[model samples]
Target: MTQTVMHLDDTDSLERFDAALDALEGHLKRVFADDSAEADRAVLAALQEQVRVLTEERDRLLTDLEAERARVQRLKEANEEVSGRLEGVMGALKDMAPALQD
Candidate 1:
């Protein structure tokens, strides 16, 4: 039996996630200080755009994760099939050894 391990390095994603949070925070601060209607609308638009970008990034990461999981599953199934075949061959060789000793 062989073991398969997966390591995920998500530094870039984490950085992006952090940046999005910071942008949202900054937008909130601006919204609180700006009293004019136009300024408020502009801030709201910026916030909405940030949300859209973050949502897209989240979706992309989820898709990538699902794909990786499927790949790992396929690899595991292939490994099991190969292991079973090897064991069958070894058993057959063992069975033939006694007859050859005659």
Candidate 2:
């Protein structure tokens, strides 16, 4: 026996619910026959697996990029510190050289 919902509208909330139920029922029926069921299951499983892998890869890349940015910031700070020290040393050298000449 086929079960059907009447007045199916994709726009209305009730229609959406009915459509979803109908789709599930069809998927189940297709799943019953060996060839149809197996093919549908395989396609769905493959799609879900691919989505999972891509999600993980995206998350990993985001983490790596953030780490790289942080490292760059730290190096910048270190470079600034070195620059300040060099300027101070140059100033001292200038002062000592003038006194030695006098």
Candidate 3:
């Protein structure tokens, strides 16, 4: 079995490379010119908009959650204050009960 090896000169190699690059560029242009490419771009734009909207919504929700947490803390503190005052009033009422009974 004999195998023949073929090699191109520098000029021929360069021409082949240029031709390959031109063919690739033409193919890419044709692909991008198709309707599907436009549809792909539109889909990408819609997805980006959705992501932006979702991010804004997430940030708003986080802000609302923080406000709710702060409100809960305030309510808890107010509840503790009210409970303390109620306990003092109950103790005073208990101390007066014996006098009222007499």
Q: Provide TM-scores for the models.
A: 0.58, 0.57, 0.62
Q: Where in model 2 is the C-alpha error above 4 Å?
A: 1-39
> What would the per-residue lDDT of candidate 1 be over residues 1-102, giving only the tens digit for each residue?
995665756556656776876787677667757776465567677877877787687778767767877887999999999999999999999999999999
Better of 1 and 2 by lDDT: 1
How many Å off is the CA of 24 in candidate 3? 32
The C-alpha lDDT values of all candidates are: 0.77, 0.66, 0.68
RMSD of 2: 18.6
True-structure lDDT of candidate 1: 0.77
Candidate 3's residue-wise lDDT over 1-102, tens digit each? 995534535346445655655565565557656866645777555655665565565566557656766876999999999999999999999999999999
TM-score of 3: 0.62
| Predicted model with the maximum lDDT | 1
List the lowest-lDDT window of 10 residues for candidate 1. Answer: 3-12
Candidate 3 — what's its lDDT?
A: 0.68
lDDT of 3 at 48: 55
TM-score of 2: 0.57
